[model samples]
Target chain A: MELQGIYILWLRDLKRYIRARSRIIGSLGMPIFFLAFFGMGFRRVEIPSLPQNITYIDFLAPGIVSMVVLFTSTFSGISIVWDRQFGFLREIMVAPISRTTISLGRNLGGATTALIQGLIMIALSFLIGFKPSINGLLFAFVFMFLIAVAFTGIGIAISTFMHDIHGFQIVINFFVFPIFLLSGALFPISELPKFVATLALFDPLTYGVDGMRWAMIGYSEFNPLYDLAALLIFCVTIVFVSAALFSKMEVE
Target chain B: MEPIVVKNLTKTFNGFKAVDSINFTVKKGEIFGLLGPNGAGKTTTIKMLVTLLKPSSGEAKVAGYDVVKQPNMVRKNIGIVFQEPTLDLELTAKENLDFHARLYGLNKKRREERIKEVLKLVDLYDKANLQVKKFSGGMQRRLEIARGLLHFPKVLFLDEPTLGLDAQTRRKIWDYIIEMKEREDVTIILTTHYIEEADKLCDRVAIIDKGKIIALDDPENLKKMVGEDVVSLTVNDPERLIDELALEEIRKIVRIEDRLELSVVKGEIMIPRMVEIAQKVGVEVKSVSLRKPTLEDVFIHLTGREIREESGKNAFWRR
Candidate 1:
């Protein structure tokens, strides 16, 4: 019954996502814009610390894919606030399923949507002058999936405490901008000031960006195994935290 | 066991008692009502019973499962239609029902069958393919009702089933509720502020006020507790008229503003006597009317205030 409940919830979200074509297109706008602007605007520029073998797009493509997953996954948590405002959360809360099952289902759905968006960003990156090793593509998918699951968990955890969409938007923006800025997505962390580079170490997306860059372009600051391990721990911790917080949530 | 048993069920919010130790039992297959004005704790009590909110103290059992200790069991056996519409507006009516059916762990074959059956019961089968966002207020409500019964739950909780609907739509919803009771043979507990809704639909009603159950009985019996007939008179100098009309036939007279509501054994016989007494007392008789006691009159007789007045005040506060 719990599995069935989770499946139904996931299926409901998927159906809603598929039906909202404008939302899908709208959400892709920012990532695609970032990709084209940075990939084209800096086509001839040379960063001092960048690897000699790969162009800037190779270094920037994986980071843009990570950004897509990060933004889409975290924003998916807003659906919880939406469901609460519209009264659908009450229906799910009173169901026979456990809160853990409900949270798991929602996170899985969010992760699936984010993963799809990340894949689209990857495909779009190819149209630009981005190049990737064919053999590393599968590992890139693994890192992307991890990024989606972990950040969607974070989004759900944050959403459990939020009641309104406007507040969630403000809070998410506050967190997302700082996380994305410090994530080494645009520039290498090694080129940053000492204190700022240390801050990048705390940003979870930094590891995601490192892991995906290693997979796609065979270039990374951190070891790929270490990145994979850090993401796994983050995923487990966030999933548990979200489930606990959501279990304690009550609707009026 | 009864479908629901509540003992000293209390819920307090920030030290303000929302449901103050209310006790009641709902027999199997009975239509029970928790009738109260807005902010009168009806929804709070339902929330406790449905396992959405924990009770601050006391205990309640629904479908033979403790709400506090065995909430999942209680949830499995009960269906709830919240006061607010809970359907996914983006989904079609049929998809919403299918989602609910799947959550209840209904088999695929049974899911299809019950979805069709329940939607047809609410007369929404033809519109099942349309998105709920396109539905009118009344249609959305009917679809909610259909979804609530999709799982064939042992106990169904409907909070304000006909709230905010037009008179005709309200009547249609009431008809569906009554027919559902007969056809499904499931115990139902609903909350409403509408006196006519309670009087027409419930087998027994518990009238709650200020987080307390003030009266509980069938509509007919509750009215009988007031008197045979109620005579309402708007006369000048109501105090003087009350003093003049001290007859054995007049059981009780309650003063509400400038009007006097007299609970009499035979209102027809007392109306003329009361009017003559007013005439003799130099008090001008403005108007007089006699009718059998209704739930509203009973509420006024017990509380010394009009239920509608409380509702109106609540409406203002809500806005």
Candidate 2:
């Protein structure tokens, strides 16, 4: 029953995303712009410890894909706010299924949408001279999915308390921009001051960015195990918290 | 088996008892209504029965399953058309029904057949592929009903199903609803403030107020309890008119704004005498209208105030 629910709901979200041509076109604009300007502006720059063969765009490409996942997944919470306002959430909540099932469906659905956004960005980056082996692409898929799950969980958790869509966006943006900036998606965490670097260790996105960097550009500041462990732990924690929070959402 | 049973069911929201201890039992295959003004806990009561809200105290069962302890079982037997619009506006009508069916774990073959059946029931089969946002308000509501019936639930909950629709649309929806009940053999629990709707559609009604069930009976019996047609008099001077019209032996007189509503068994016979009294008292009778005794009169007889007055003006389309 739960498997079917998650499948159907996940399909529903994907179907909606596919149908909303404006949304697909609109959400892609920021990530593509960041890749273009940032990648182009920093093209010649190279970090000292990074391999000499790696260009700035190559370094930024995987991080940009992770950025797409972060923004898209967190923004997926907007659907919950909308579902509440439009009354669809009530239908789902009142169904025979458990709240955990409902939350899992929604989380997986949101994460899938975010992963698709990541894939699109990765493909776009590939066209603009960002190259990776098939093996790297496969691993990037896993890392992007993990990142998607974590942020989607964050999004759903935030949305449970937000009655207004405007308030939801304002709050999610509070998470999205900071998580992007502080996670060293735009720059290396190695260059940060001591306290800021310490904070980066706590930012879940930092692990995602480092994982992506390792996968795509063959660079790593820490053992890949740390990234995998940290992201998995964060993903599970967020999912648990989101499922608990979503159970308490009132119909009215 | 009885489709629904409630005993001392109550729900409190932050200490405000939204659904006070209410007891009722609904026979199978009946159109039951929770009729009241807004905030009278009609919606709250339905929420509890549908397993959307938990009772703060007491017990209820739907489809022979306890609502609190076996909410999933209760939900399995019931479908709800919420007071708010629950359809996915972005999706087509068919997709909405299809998704809801899948959520209920309907297999593909049964899902397809039920979708076609329900859509045809609501006469929305032709517009199955249209986006719900593009559909008229009435069509959207009908689609919602179709979605609710997708899984063939044993009990269907219509929470103000006809709210915010025009009279014509409401009537059409009512016809579809009755048709649904008969065709599907589903027990329906409806909540409505429209006295006429409760009178026309509900086999039995429980009039609620301030989180309590004030009266429960078939519409005929409840109206018999009041047993008076409502004669509303818009007079130039109501205070003087009431004093002069004392000979009519009015059962109840509720003064609302500039209108005086008099309850009497023979409103048709009394209007002429009321007019004569108005002339005798030198108060110009602005307008006089006689209405048959309805659930509204029953409500006014019990509550001392008109139900329509305090209810929010959210349904501006009511007229």
Which CAPRI tier for candidate 1?
high
Off by over 4 Å in 2: B316-319
Model 1 CA deviation exceeding 4 Å by range: B312-319
Q: Score the docking of each candidate (DockQ).
A: 0.81, 0.82
Clashing pairs in 2: none
DockQ of 2: 0.82
- Per residue, candidate 2 scores C-alpha lDDT tens digits across A158-250 of 888888777865674677788898888888888888899898889999999988888877787778789989999999999999999998777
- Top candidate, metric DockQ: 2
TM-score of each: 0.96, 0.94
How many clashes does the backbone of model 1 have? 0
Worst 10 residues of 2 chain A by lDDT: A168-177
Write the residue-wise lDDT of candidate 2 on B1-319 in tens digits: 7999999999999999999899999989999999999999998898888877778999998999999899889888888898888888888999989889988999999999999999999999999999888998899889988888888889999999988898999999999988887888799999998988998899999999999999999999998876568898998788877777766468778777678888888889988988987898799988999987788888988887778886648886531
Q: Across the candidates, what are chain A's individual TM-scores? A: 0.97, 0.96
B1-319: candidate 1 lDDT, tens digit per residue: 8999999999999999999999999999999999877888999999999988899999999999999999989998999998888999999999999998988899999999999999989999999999999998889999999899989899999998887787899999999999999999699999988889999999999999889999999999999988999999998799988887888888888999989999989889888888888888899988889999888888888888777775643322221
The interface root-mean-square deviations, each candidate in sequence, come to 0.8, 1.0
